[model samples]
Target: MEIVKNRFLKGVTVVLSALLVISLMGCGQKTDAKTTEAKTVSENVKRMPDEMTKVNLGLPSNKNMSYLPFYVALKKGNFQKHNLNVNLSVVQGGVLALRGLQSGDFQIISSLPESVITGASEGANVKLIGTLDIQSMYSIYVAKDIHDPKELKGKVAASMVPGNGTDIQLQYWLKKHGLEPNKDIRIINAGDNAERLQTLQQGQSAVTILSPPTDLKADELGYKRFLMRDELKTYNHNMIAASGDQIKNKPEVIYAFMAAEAEAVTFIKDKANRDEVIKIVMEQMEMKNADAEKSLDFVLPALADHGKINIEGIKWAIDMVKEAGVLKKEINLDKLLDERFYAK
Candidate 1:
């Protein structure tokens, strides 16, 4: 009985020792994986220059994923590579951002070319240097109860702000669907997609236009997809504009800034950077990996190339603005766009 007991005890000790070794190995692997990920993130972040040129870039909304390339550039050191120190801020309204640009509060801003067109018409002396999003990700989403587009009649909707990109987008889509905006349904200037989503959830608005992460969330909530915007391919969305004064005084700065943006967009478009860019989308937009991946495939093909504005797309925006009552008379597109910077 003593011999049998000794053998059993020895077997039990060997099994426990083996289990301990396996556990330690697994923990080491997990540590290594985490360290590698951290290293990657650290490597991707660009360090600020000690004596960098200062440029403030304003954004329409902080949460909109349509402007991901700009964030990517900030993360990927494209700005630093181009010898520019871009300080990005939320200017709230596209027109306000443009106003800030003109007043010297902001050096550059990302907005729909229509806003820039309207500003040019209103005598703000701003010019679009580059187009960021050619095929807009903006799509109309309605509440679950309101299934049909016409059902949106007499219902309320939300936008980024009055006469901004999202508002114009909502109006344009409404007109396309045979419903007169403000005549058929009431559209109010709420806020960004994030804020708009909150208002929608609270039943303040039954319909709104949203971008990627917000759009993905709206889908999960079973909101009715009123207008996918896949048909409106001719019109471009976001553009980088500098005040006429900035364009005249510091054309080189505009060129460097635009070049960095172009590099960032190119980097995001590359298949080799797919994993990293998708990771960026997930982190920056606070989305799951699945949603990020889904958005990547949905939005990748729609990005503008070399940060150059499409002449045809600009024309489309001008036409839309004219119809929206933002522009009373025809303005020459040739004079509005500073194509020299983008051409380089």
Candidate 2:
């Protein structure tokens, strides 16, 4: 009777041990499955979007020649190839584009360095990423009756808009002639390219600043080109700037744009593809062949070498602004230039 009871107890103990082993195995299997699932979930997670990183391109309207490199890059899909989405915004004038950049409406503003320096002095968060034009592609045009820049003391002159690159250049030209701006010359803020054209035609302004396409228009209308860069011992233009915040976060996008831009500048400068490039320039700008030619001529010397930043040109522009009382404090020129990206 004792042996039978002991045997029954042993059988019960064996059954309970088997059940406990099976339950432990089940728990281990569940733990392994959860670990696998957690890893899978981690791998499947999506990256957070950089809401602050976006490219806003601002250029001038009507003067399509100024946008040659950008258009070439866009039409050739260079920007897209580099994994960037650039929204091209055409403003009325370069100054307006600078203002848009300052007001936070645009990310990249295309204009002369003077505007950027002025904005920086005024405490706007801006920095010049790169320069497209290193020399003066602009000329000061006056009526045929007026030859000397000093002849327009009492006469009315028009610029693209107040504080625009055109205005700043015109002021610089005026100062070079030993004339005081705003006091010696009655400078008016004509709206933009079209308005400046209208102002010149309607005799609202005796003298006006003009670029290639507009200068071609001015020539067709018989406006006299009294002064060009060849006449002045100066380098006149530069691609102004973008926000500093944009530079820190969206450096990769800027690198892509700069690389493509460098290629476009090289292509435009090549004599082999000159005609084709001119045609593309005309088609993109919607200008006549004569205007296209004029713009190409203007862009020829102003365009810098491939992927090169004009440190001297930028310094000159900054110095000019400082002299003009546009900048309140001096800035470190080296800090403004970041070439480490290209090096990488």
Instruction: Report the C-alpha lDDT of model 2 over 154-173, residue by residue, as the tens digit.
Output: 88878755555677677877
Residue 103, model 2: lDDT of 77
Candidate 1 on 1-344: residue-level lDDT in tens? 99999999999999999999999999999999999999998565433333468899988777667788888999999888877888988966788888888889888998887778888887787888887777877777887788678888888888766666667778888887778878888878787778888778889998888887778888988877753457676766778899889887777688778788888888998899999998898888888899989888877877888887778878877877777777876689777988777623
TM-score for each model: 0.80, 0.75
lDDT, model 1: 0.80
Clashing pairs in 1: none
Candidate closest to the true structure, highest TM-score: 1
lDDT of every model, 2 decimals = 0.80, 0.71
Clashing residue pairs in all predictions, respectively, total: 0, 1
Error of 1 at 182 (Å): 2.2
